[model samples]
Target chain A: MLGVLGGMGPLASAEFMRRLTLLTPAERDQDHIPAVLWSDPRVPDRTAARLGGGEDPLPALLRGIRGLEAAGCGAIAIPCNTVHGWFEAMQAATPLPILHIVDAAAAELARLGVPRGRIGVMGTAGTLAMRLYQQRLEGRGYECLVPTETEMARLVTPGIAEVKANRVAEAHAPLAESARALAARGARAVVLGCTEIPLGIAAGPPLPFPVCDTIDALARAAIGWARGA
Target chain B: MLGVLGGMGPLASAEFMRRLTLLTPAERDQDHIPAVLWSDPRVPDRTAARLGGGEDPLPALLRGIRGLEAAGCGAIAIPCNTVHGWFEAMQAATPLPILHIVDAAAAELARLGVPRGRIGVMGTAGTLAMRLYQQRLEGRGYECLVPTETEMARLVTPGIAEVKANRVAEAHAPLAESARALAARGARAVVLGCTEIPLGIAAGPPLPFPVCDTIDALARAAIGWARGA
Candidate 1:
């Protein structure tokens, strides 16, 4: 059974579960993967703590992992990209494999037939600060494009914030604007690196450029692991 | 924090979480109600046991209840209507308040401005057998309309089974046929008592008669409790 360590923002985790069920090749409830979602929204803001003086979210993350472990979960998946900044520490604390969102997104990019050229990465400021997607995807031989500080402040950040506030339709303009900007600058594809960004993007029109949704990517990864792929 | 005792068929529980999120009048992630979904799909079939020659789900249910209590959930909501047959026994085993699905459905019927005429109740055989909704709705001065054994065996049962198997589109026809029959028989409104029914209903055309989705009703009740309504 998979353990979903979520509520890093509840909507994303729930979306992952919804996507998991959709993506699975199952004929019945019994054929579907059995999982537990330890969705404690009380876990302190991951991006805040990583960016500066917010309280540490490590203890809470570990508690979720241990709780799922106690519940007999064979593996774990945390749907938030910003929180993956703590991935190493969290993984070190548990024996179970925590599916890596960056790896999942990279694999999804490949599956989408995105050439190994340029990829845009959009996420919470903390995810960019930690260079989460860039570092790993770059290692996979793809050059990364990111939002400028002005673009981040003016469009991406506020767009993600609106999604967190449930103003999904309002979030699209700014997020799409940023993604379009990245595409104009030669980005082959844009990674909706933050979980919130995908919700924001889905709120409005489809992007002209090929794009990868990390939530779906991570969900596919979790499904793969569950199905022993 | 709200504890969702789900996975009485994983899809329904996940839908409950989705409905809970959508119904909440929140402007941001923090403003949404905090919840943990203990979605263990391993619990034995409720309908099978009630009809005889099947394993009892009590011990598994009790484990889930205690697990939620230990996780510091302030209240509990079980989304599956059929499992509510064990409501008293489960509630007796926990200090945390378990929200009643029938009461929530009754209140929703009132909120929707349905008159005190015949209200249809559709659910798993166990829920009907245990009189989970029938007796309670009857007490509220509402005439209860249930599917005949033929309707249950032919339409309702197979439709629900398809939903459990994630064949939502296929489930729609039989389920809709059942609802139309109920409305033709003078049902003022139908309470989609089974969690899976609403999903099936949503897949196809909308019902002419007013309908109350127990999942949404139950979610509203959870929100009410969380917000002190």
Candidate 2:
């Protein structure tokens, strides 16, 4: 059973669990995988940790991992994309394999055979500030693009906050426009690096190329891993 | 895969899912049952439907069940206790067998050999107002007890609302007192009929006997059914 270490924002955790459910192929109650979720919202903020403005999230995260491990969880998956800044440390904290969201997204990109594609990334300012995905994608020979400061404040910030506020409809138009601009800049696909983006944006019409929703991609990857694909 | 027809209250839905995750015993990701959850807070109030005060919830409920069924959910479970009042109509609305929280609770009581015992039930004013559990338990030869109007308003109401608001810490004392009174009234076990109740009052010291957490019981049943045991 995979243990979900979540509450990086409760909605993201909920989405990850919903994705797991939707991806499972079953005709009845008897056909589904078990999951243990430790969704303690009390954990220190990931952005705060990344910005070095608050307490480290690693200790609380380690406590969660230990709780799941003691509860007999097999592999662990963290839905928060940015917590991966301390991914290596968090992984070392638990004996269970911590499934890297970045690696999973990168693997999906590789399998789609968009070799050396330019990918647009949208996430928390902290996530962008770290250039985590940019580094990871560039390491795999792909270019990663992000919105500029003004656009980040206008599009990404409101989009994520809207999701956090459960007001997705209000943020939809701006996100669509942002994705369109990214596609115009030669990005093959837009990676909704923020877990909250999928909750708001509808990318198909405004964006010329496909918007590879990282949440959907992560869900698909989880399904494949569960099915031993 | 199990489809959860929930979001009558977000916290209630979350607690039900937590119970399911905690109950399943699996060593690997593929070893557990998968779940699809449709938590449409948009579903009309069940109390309103019962009292003929508002639009029927069946339409919105059908939408939730259909979403999960279309996604290939094998069995459907509705987490909200009060919503089970519309179970017959909901079943008529879909081809799938949507499990009833009432039936699951009754069955657990029967299995525990406390079939005719005095059971204290705690739920929303709407659920208690419906007497869904009272009727079901009476049909199965059990005596059911609900809190008086004063107790309902002072204890059950705020306790349930605290859970819905995610103010679980604030709910503890009020629920503990209620548990004691119910046990004092010769109740053998307290039935946490409302999903929110389980989140706030799962294992309190004041209860005379086992607190038959219906959400946990339903989840255990779901897990058992999922494992084909």
Candidate 3:
């Protein structure tokens, strides 16, 4: 069975599960894949941890990973994009196959035949700072573009915050503006690197460039892995 | 930490977690209650099993409960209302505190101070057949009203099935009709005894009397227990 190591923000985790269900080919409950979710929201903030200003989320993340493994999960997926900053560490710590959100996004980009230049990335400060998307996509011969520091600080971060606070409607304008800015900067396609950004942007107007939601990518990857196994 | 014995229908389980997060007063992740969710959608159909034509869900339910207990959850909450038909048996097999969904609904009824007679109940055929809501509320001095056999077969059952099939919008009309019928039959308040009912009915016209959502009531009860502990 697959496991979800979640609750980076509870709603995102919940949304991921909902997407997983919607993506599965099932007519009844039994036809769907089984999953174990360890939703311990107490894990410290990923942005704070990555910035060296708050408690590290590693210990809590490891605890959740172990809990899912103990429940007999054969593979695991962490839905939060920012937490993918510690992808290598989490992978080394667990023998089980770990589905990386960034890798999934990169794979999706390749599958969609998004050209190898100027792919936009939008997410939390921690995700951009760690170069999670850049490192993964660049190694695949793609250049990544991100919102300006001012936009990240003023628009992207607050947009994600609004979603976490359950004010999804309020987050749309800023997120749309940021997406527009990234596309105007010559980004061929934009990756919604944060989970909350998808929810906010989904309710708003459509973007000019192709948008890839990491949450959907990760959920699709997990479903494919589970179904294949 | 609380353990969620879920995936009796996966979306309902996800909704319960979403509600748990929303009901909590936490401004940050750490202040919210921690939960371990085993969303094994492969569990045999509760309605089919209880009716004696399908595989029993007891073994799977027991396994989920034990998995959570092994993970160090102090109490367990099963989000599905129909599963409470086996609450006593589940509680007897495990030492962990098991939160009862019906009791939570009854408590909400009392808290709302609705006069104790002719409370309408709508849910899966199995939950009504077992009198899961009736016994608990009747003990507290409230009479129960369920859809007539024709209504159950024609409107209520199909409406619930539609929601489970993710056709929530289509379920609205039939469910609203059921609620109106119950109210016209002298039901002072209608208890959405099934978790799916709330999702289906939310989009429909407002009911004539007060509506009690068992899923929300159960989530509130679980949060209260987790927080108080």
Candidate 4:
């Protein structure tokens, strides 16, 4: 069984489950992956905690991890990218193989036939500050492109805010504009590093260049694990 | 937190989760209801068990209920219809309020303003044989319409099987045909008693007759409980 540690924002997590179902090549209900979604909205904000502006979310994150482990899950997937900032600590706390969002994105980049050119990584300030995608993808031989501070302040941050508020339609233009900025900067492909960003991008028209959605990427990873298990 | 006792057909339960978030009126992430989904497909088939053809699923159902209670869920929603055949035992085993799919459908009927007419009930053989919806809705001043055994074997049954197999597109024609047959027999509205039926119906073009989806109805009930609590 797969455990989804979610509700970093509720809708993104729900969309993850939906995508997980659609992406699985199942012939019957029994053939589909069995999952337990520990969706507690009370977990403190992952970005705020990482930025030193709020209470630590590690305890709550650990609680969800323990709960899923107790529920008999073999492995776990966290849909929210910002939460991956605590990946090492949470993974240490649980014996379950907690899938790394950045690793999944790296695999997706390879799957899309994207090579060592500049790759745009879009996500929360915490993810950027901690160098979640940049460090890993750079080590994997891909140069990373990120939003400028001005762009983050005016576009990327608030666009994510809109998605979290369930006003997904309103989030599209700003998010798309930020991605367009990356594409103009000569990015090979932009990764929707945040789970909510994919929902936002999907609300509007398509992006002109290739974009990797970590939500779908993570779902694919979980499905791969389920199929193999 | 709301508890979803699901996986009686994994896709149906996942759709219930998707609808739960979409149906909730929220401005921010926290405004959406907190939910824990226990989607274990290993529970023996409900219809087979009720027909005395398989192992009783009561133990597994009870286990899921207990797990949700331990996880701090206040109320529970079981999306699958045939499982409600054991609703009494399950409810008796747990103090938490288990939302009834039939009651939700009945409320949806009132909400849709379909009052005191012949209502069609479509579901698995266990649900129809047990008269789950008919007994309750008929007691509330509505006559019940049901598909004949011929219709069940040829149309409704096969259609539901298609949905369970995740070939939702293939399920549409036969399920819609069964509903049309009911409408022709003077049913005022058709009730999609089984959770899988709605998925099948929605996959096809819109039905000309009024039909109630128990999955959405159940989600609404769960949302209402979360709000009021």
TM-score of each: 0.94, 0.54, 0.95, 0.94
lDDT of 1: 0.87
Decide which is better by DockQ, 2 or 3: 3
Root-mean-square deviation per candidate:
2.1, 16.8, 1.9, 1.9
State residue A152's C-alpha deviation in candidate 4, in Å: 2.9
DockQ-based class of model 3: medium
Instruction: Quantify all predictions' global Cα lDDT against the true fold.
Output: 0.87, 0.71, 0.86, 0.88
The residue-by-residue lDDT of candidate 1 on A1-229, one tens digit each, is 7899987677787878877777777665567777878887778887789888799999998988888887778999988999999999999999999999999998899988895889899998999999998778777789999999999999998998787666779999999999999999999999999988888898887888789999899989998898783
All candidates in order of TM-score, best leading: 3, 4, 1, 2
Candidate 1 vs candidate 2: the DockQ winner is 1
The alpha-carbon lDDT assigned to residue B116 of candidate 2 equals 72
- lDDT string for model 3 (B1-229, tens) is 8999988788778888888877777655566678888899888888888876788889999999989998899999888888888899999999999999988888787777784877899988899999888888887788899999999999998988776776779989999899989999998889998888888898777776789888789889998898689
Which is better, 1 or 4, measured by lDDT? 4
User: Comparing to the true complex, what docking class would candidate 1 get?
Assistant: medium
Runs of candidate 3 exceeding 4 Å displacement: A110-115, A203-205, B111-115, B203-208
Per-residue CA lDDT of model 1 for B59-140, tens digit only, reads: 9999888777777789999998988888889988998999999889988998889847887889999888888886777766
Tens digits of per-residue lDDT, candidate 2, A62-133, equal 877776676566787787787888888987777888777877788667666665668888787888999989
Candidate 2 docking DockQ: 0.03
Per-prediction DockQ comes to: 0.57, 0.03, 0.65, 0.62
Candidate 4, A180: how far from true, in Å? Answer: 2.7
DockQ for model 3 equals 0.65
